[model samples]
Target: MTTAPASGFQTRRIVESAAACSGAVVAGLSLMVPLDPRMMGNTSALEVSLTVLNAPRSAAAGAMLAVVAAVYAMIFGARVAWCASFVAASVLLICAIAISGPVSSGSLAIVNFIECVTAGILVGALAAATLRRPGVGTAYTVGILCGIVIGDQLQMPEAGAAMSRWRWLYAAAPPLWLSVLAVVLLGVGLYWHRDQAPIVSESTVISNVPLVPILAGALMLTVVTTTSEWTARYDFGAAGLVCEILVLAGAALVAALLLPGQDGTLILLATATASAGSAVVAVPHPRWSWSLTLAALALGFLAGRLRPAPLVAAGLTTALAVYAVLTCGIAHTYLLLPVIGCTATAFVLGYAFGAAVPHTVSGMVLGIVILVAPCMIVALRGHENGTVGYSPNWYRDPNGTEGLLPPIVAVAVTLGCTLGILLLRQLRPVTAGHIRRLPGRALGGKFA
Candidate 1:
């Protein structure tokens, strides 16, 4: 028996994906500067805000821009597409700065949105490209989500308290400081990743992968994530932390134990357990958020070593959607359901998407759109209906969220049904052994 050359191992693309994933995480985390104020229904005391640059809108813009960049990656591959995104983002930033300043103006806000959107687009493209690797999709997922956990952790401190505590960082143009850091991180990621050379040469096309399940998984993730954000908004202490730690650790252990084998089955089990655990523990925890993120990173590292499959992505996504629907429907009756269910859903969704859709730019965008649409609706609707997030202002004025259940049910129901139907036609993987025979299926079956 002859062994492959040492160059084979050296050619691993996981590091590149992981690095890009880190940049995406920072982008998500650092974006807090511009997006937070927009969501809070207040103007940024820091800069001239845009007319339409609220939190939800900004996020939507980022998602859309990223989708576009991903499309480009689909056509031109990562190298050309990312370079284009960099050029485009730079131009947008210059334009944003030219119009932004002390005086708040709609045009300035628009410019700012454009700039951030550009960053988001590149991040999305990079994420999708990274997913194209054999075992790196999960790592990228870990980095991006972990970034969110870190940012949220930092954000937990009250503005005044945070400002006072991190005085030097927050004092003179905190947003600027954060933005620069984001840009630097992104640049470093792009440079470090440069290109997924080996993966590209070895694998290029996604084959026999059902689009519906991919989309379903993406949409399922969106619902879970949105709900998670809201659920995590509340608090849970020591017990929650311990639980989160265990779940995250368990997720990684499970992934390491089973991957690059039964691609879909691994994700199915992984997503179910992860979400179930997170929901049980709850989110928005003060100390445990970072710990949870650390756990996710571990999951990513382990999962990245394995391949992902569509059947499992779809099943897991369907199950999560069902779970979310069930949880949201009964949240009124069972108080703990929302916190446990949504948080669990979010964690699982994050892992599932990272594992399932990392390499498919189009699939990633579809999932992102599914994820962002509800937030956009709620954010925009909040302006009109006086609802916060989706279900209303439980934090401030509980009465405002009274009619919220209907909308929540509506969104959840709509997503669940669509994905459930999509699942019917998707080919199911019977065993993990298929992963060994059809490893290229993880690449979406496109062989060049």
Candidate 2:
């Protein structure tokens, strides 16, 4: 019932504008600076160039840094935001300095540590600032960072010294740092704001849907399918099945906590459909590619109609489709039968459980289940065949092939399946309760 104070709102607006500006500047600089060419030549030269590039990336990083700063500012005022910014900057600087030696000259080399640290600090600051600025969200910060990382990846060469160095850094340092920084920033902000009342909270009387279960189920389906392919020889089916059951149970438990009249079964159903679509892709069947494409389209359509729950499911399914496409080329013929079967099984299990659980809890439970299942399978299977196989000019010179087409096919099938699903769901009428109920809300609810 309580609203944000006038001062809080005004400060949030100011910080939001600053955060947007910072993000724009950072995005521009990230594209302009060439990380690869600058880090060329001798190690000394590389170090110098990296330090020089640091200034621009640092400025860009300011958007995220401001987000964190704003979070502190909102809870403890401007002084706290400033202090947090200073601390964040110092921490990043120290991390960069410590890791610089490896990138320059060392037996156990450190790759993009300098660039990542510098960028990370700026991002952290922006994130803090954005969080502090009440109405301002973290969208700009996330968008800029994703763009920089993707751009860096796309621009990097696949072969030679530069590429080798880039890959080493990409695999080891920057990602780890970013992950750590994200966790730290989120944790700190949450801790500081724990006592503060939320600006918005959904009521049980509105409709009791389990957001967690739906997400968990969808994630579980993805992981299980991915793991089954990654560890084809493993027998983790029982464990995966158990996880699905747990997700459904959790959803049911959450539903029990809501108001008596609440109903989120439709949401659970929608999530299940999307999760199933994603699982089909993971299975890697040639036909599954088409299935995945269809599923993605269907989920997307349902998401638009269902609001929050379906949207989440659609996003997850879309991710699955993307992963499938990237891993598998356009040809679905290369996908293996076993991979497809496993993926399908996982999807079916997730869908069944997701549909059975309470709407209130389904999303979170499903997400957790999806996330954990494949990881467990992978761990149980061990990593004997984890090596990356290279194929020289696969399209241009098929004679110089290295790996089998099964994996590739698996990827393709998933993509196709996702697209197909989406298309079908989108074209279907609103009266078709199957797609409409998928995200838990009635057709004429908020979506109408």
Index of the highest-lDDT prediction: 1
On residues 155-222, what C-alpha lDDT tens digit does candidate 1 reach at each position? 22233443345454432212344444444544544565475542333343343323433333333334
User: Could you tell me which 10 consecutive residues in candidate 1 have the lowest summed lDDT?
Assistant: 390-399
lDDT of 2 by residue, 406-448 (tens): 3333333333333433433354322433331223232112211
Candidate 2 ranges beyond 4 A from true positions: 1-78, 103-128, 132-141, 144-157, 161-327, 331-448
Model 2 clashes, total count: 104
Model 1, 239: alpha-carbon shift in Å? 41
TM-score of each: 0.54, 0.33
